[model samples]
Target: MQKNKQWNVKGAMRLAGTFHFLHSCASGCLLPFLTLYFRHLGLTATMTGIIMASRHMLALVWRPISSVLARQHDKRRAVVVGSLFSSASVVLILLLFPSEGLKAESGRCNASQLNANVAEDGGEFTTLENLPQFNATVYSVYNTTVVTEQSNDDDTAEYTPTPLISNSTRSVRKVRSLQEEHPHSEFLGSLKVMDAQHQMFFLVLIVTGFWEFMAVPLEWTADDGLYEYLDFVDATDRHRSAKIWKQLGAAFGNGGVGILVTGLYCLTGTTAEFYSYAILMILTVPAAALLPLYLRKRERRTSGGFKALQLVHGNSQALLCAVTVVLTGMASSVVSDFLLWQMQDHNATETHMGISLALAHFSQVGFVPLAGRLARFLKYHGWLLVLAVIALSLQCLYYSFLWGPWTVIPAQLLAGISTGAMWWSVESQCEDIATPGTEKTMFRVFELLSLELGAGFGSLMAGFVVQKFGLSVLFQGTALILALWSIALALLKWKIPRQRRINYSRLLAADMTEMSESDSDQEKDWLETAMDDSKQKNKWTMDKPSK
Candidate 1:
């Protein structure tokens, strides 16, 4: 009985759900916190953006290789390995967390010395503009010294070493003079200091990206595996059910983990928040290992990962889909990376920021099911994309003019539409059009490409914009892009030939029917062969009865 019930379609879905939930918990810990952590390290906006971009940018090289490996090896094993690496990366990030504080301490020491000098000068000016000029006179120090001389005949005399007199001019006055000579010297100086500080954090950023590249694909494979398993089992409402479970997991991760981490951050403070992240990442490893056990034998069989290539080429709709996905990603990155900053900019606490994020994720509980229902009606599969555009644009606009920390709650509630609807639509459409053996592989490839192009570039671009402009400009610019993209999508939909708007649901139903018939026929053939063999064995036994 235990053997008979070892695994089933429902069991596989449950496992997939578990994987998503744990994965979300791990990511939630990082997403809202990591960028702020960088800022806390005294890293400038550009460095923070670079770190965010690098997380996805590195996937460019690893994604293809990872997909190939998952196809060639056991995807479960691949995911387990990725989880272990993720855990390592989290621990390393935690270890490096103290470096920021140390650097800050060093800066404070420098400031203290300057303060002492100012106090000694008895300067009364309180502002940089009204600060008095320092005298440029050189200061000299003299000390007694003894000298020894040796004769040409190698005679030596003993002597005591003493400090030598020295005279040096302090550069403070020169720096002030230079400041007067060059109006932009302060900015230049700051830029130089920022460059130097970046050198220290660069390695940390690279290490952070390492696990992200590894874990993201592994998680995608596992997540997509569940959907593929549902298809293999010929489950009813596969698309909707799979998305519901996935979103449910996300809701749990985002709401529960988001609040937990936020509370931890507030309790332990920003400097120690990495500890919470590391602990959460450690939990993902065990969760990932359970994925393979849920898959049936046939589902576990290897197919080439590169099989996705057939669908990617010459598919115009898929191409358009990619464009929209990229736009959505760019807009989403602003919220994920800097929403906390925006909250703090409004004088909100970390707890308030966490609540806002939790609200966004929790809202998905309501919309994911709605997306599933909407999918039942749309034959073309593009309606969800439309919803995604409108919702995402609205969310971006809301964020652009966000009034308070509490405001993020509404913005994130709108976010549920974008995340739930877009993710469901993308996965469902890709699976709907994918070739039979390439569903899993195609999902992995598409996810990597879309996220890297969209979110990666978005973070990098946002960083540069934030550096040059400000956060307000960044949000407004992002909102404008999304708004224009939405208009473009509407126009594209209108231009589509009426005949070309195919009925995706009918195609999906036909595909399911064909698969079910094939399975039924195979089962019938196996049973008939078994009965014939049993009859032949009985005849042979009767023929040998005389013995």
Candidate 2:
């Protein structure tokens, strides 16, 4: 009788599903209400868009810094704690949930402390019955428990927080049981049938990436998923408004997740309810693991912090990587923009490029899992780099100098291949050379700077070349230079030592480290600061925004 433990696909799926729920819910739940919150703070839609975009742009900086912080600090703990901050952000965001939703909520049900924030201790888990005595039609409360046959008398499903609650039936009377404990019984304040519909449909549409990630463990063994994803996606070109529409839907969805979580909090109307979300995010299980180590470090007994980050086997190489990443990122951007340029150059409609770009997302969801194959093949960083440079160079030439806009279809496919392989190469290199506990952060910076700094520079560079040298000169010259650079990277990829290996576990572990949130103020402050910095990137590059 292995109580508290069951191992099987169904069980795994359940556990994994729960994790997936948290992951997706956390990632995509913001948009339904966050902008509304910002508006409450007296910002317009355009202003809100700017703020949101700024936040993403700031992520270019934070992604790396946070990665570094995770490496130096506790990766697992950071994830858990990070979750807390994310949760708190949700609550704060809810304070601004659309008043319409709130008004709709008015006097609907007995939301005990519906107007309140935190519930009393010893009174964990909420239900329609336990809510305030409003005698209304609907009930919105937290700490609702669902008891299944698997539950024990101690009530094990306690900490599992439900994100929302909407009920249609009114309670005949309030039943005060010491605890709602019964075997083979489930608490159904929620519409299971409707929830199943929403969840199943949402799962179908949204969890496209989740199942792919689930296969990571299978990488060490046989993998058909990877190959299949790549084989098909590598051939795709999302060249339609429908394709772009899907991407827009996703972006908007991500934005919506932020808003929805906030709405949940506002619905609660409890004091410090927002703060508690922050607390929950920070207290995710991963963060809890670092408590002892953190406690010791707090006493000045050395924390896991590192002062130096290594590149190239501790060869005292600094800024070399930074420069490399910046250039590579610029190159990647050039790849994207050049294809667009070619299409435009050939009199292709703006709609074509937009659809083509949207196709990139389809490729992303399709290719990432399979991309690992190329990574597997080119286990060495140098080899990976060579492959990337060569692919990108060829792609540039094909689109700019040789083929016309129609050639862009193949160009996008190859670019995906190049990006896929480039990731493997850099990651392989990073793994071989990275300092312990700092790899995530180091790579974070690598990716962020390379992508953003590169795109920023590439856009300008392409613009300048087109303006001064003529489009022909720009395209041909870029191809020639990139070709040479690709050859050099190939030489390097071939030449670098083979001792370094970036295993799947380390990569997964690193990702998991920052999966959680920061403290309420920490995330808010950081995001605000990031937004401020981003505004400077374009709009107010000279002056920082006032906090």
Candidate 3:
């Protein structure tokens, strides 16, 4: 029996970890690439931010509803429902409103390439010699015209009608009529072919982001369930091992899929990449369903109250941590949403972008387990989180000075360390602080209070910043905010007593036993009340008979 129970626990962990991996595989395909997709639609940075912010905004509401359900019913139910909703949304959006803008840049040819291809058609090759390589300015937009005129000492003019040029997602075509009239014109400026595609893309993203947020709470719930299962199996200290498994899954999921998506884009083209991502999101539902099957059905906690609010008010450290997460969220939103565009600006190809992201996530496969070991040795999760914040600040500074596309590779090491450690430490701290019966509630509340709220405001703020000042200023400003947040974290560490901080992990292991005792005590009190009521009724019956 003992051996069987242990095997069951191990099986549960593997299943849960696999689920985490699949979900991340889906996210890795979409989240980092969404900015580029939006740009393909000709939507501005501000509009992208609004779509991103909508997810976090809806998450704030979902957390509360999911928390209530978890407290009132089985936590697994919420997880299952969220997965189904997310799967449906992804499918609907992909089938009904596919964006053509992503396809515009797919295998497009530049003016020089077009000239060479045209020459090849006549069994000749165009040489680079005497080409108007210096005088011509290439404007990339679809259905736009460019006429180039060359002059010699004879005062004779030669006109060259440039083929369509596509730099990124925008493409332009030359007008034959305009080129004929401007035979002597030296240069023709860029003109854009405007359409309703950008607006259509915006509407689709908003709807898609909304459905995605609906599933957010379920993922959190599933993760917490795994941790609680470890505690139940008397493996609380080994919780990091479970997290390591999750990270490993994410590493494989992200790294493997990223490479495949890039490969597919090169082969079948851009439509292949978008459809592949949609399929990944759909796969998340079945993988997510597997998680709930292994989760322990939690005992119901008392429902309906401002537990989240009370937690913030009662715990000064928690409040400070929440504030820091807001800054962290603001910083993260800017980097995750715009980093692709930055890479593109530095002349990175789709394959290069995919590889860079894969490298970053793969780097975490090693760093996350190491951070867990370091946290255990230090015996203080709080300081580890502070260090993670310091790492974030450094990465932000690095991004501010970004010159080459490869520069982002080194910064990703910082990303895995900071983000992975911060989440692990924060969840552990929440477990320690929660009252005996309200563990999941506390975790969910803090997650929303810190991560979601911060992410939401950060996305909104990033849009406005990108619009007004520019992308470079956004990176610098994020670094400055992180620096300030680090100081605040330092102050929080100083104010909170070391003894109190060290006692958290010890207290967490006893929460279940304490809850059991509390339930027994409540049962005893109810029995005593019922016996007293029976005695009073007997006395009243005897007195009435005598009268």
Query: Taking the candidates one at a time, how many backbone clashes does each contain?
Result: 0, 45, 6
Q: Residue 161 lDDT in model 1?
A: 19
Q: Between 1 and 2, whose TM-score is larger?
A: 1
TM-score of each: 0.68, 0.40, 0.67
Q: Write down the RMSD of candidate 1 (Cα, Å).
A: 13.4
- What does the lDDT come to for candidate 3? 0.61
- lDDT per prediction? 0.60, 0.42, 0.61
Q: Rank the candidates by lDDT, best first.
A: 3, 1, 2
Q: Identify the leading candidate in terms of TM-score.
A: 1
lDDT of 1 by residue, 280-343 (tens): 5577666666664323444445554555655655466666677788788877887788777776
Number of the top lDDT candidate = 3
Residues forming the 10-long window of minimal summed lDDT in candidate 3:
122-131
Residues 228-342 of candidate 3 have per-residue lDDT tens digits of 6666676655545655555555555445555665565434433444565556656766656655333435565455237755865677777766766667777777887887777
Q: Which residue ranges in model 1 land beyond 4 Å of their true spot?
A: 1-3, 8-15, 78-82, 85-90, 95-196, 224-267, 294-310, 372-380, 498-547
Off by over 4 Å in 2: 1-308, 311-324, 337-342, 361-381, 401-406, 470-472, 493-547
lDDT of 2 by residue, 1-547 (tens): 5643321323322332233333333332332233333322333223333333333344444444443344344343444444444444534533532221111123333434343223344222222223343212122222232322235444432333223221211121122221244322333323232322232323322222232222122111111121222223341121111223333444333333333333453454322323433433343334233222121133222222233233442532224344555666766655544443345445443334434444444554455566567556755345555666677666667665534434466665665556656665566556566665455445545665676656556645664564455446655666677677766655553454445445544554464345556543453445568887787787764576777
Backbone clashes in model 1, listed as residue pairs = none
Better of 1 and 3 by TM-score: 1
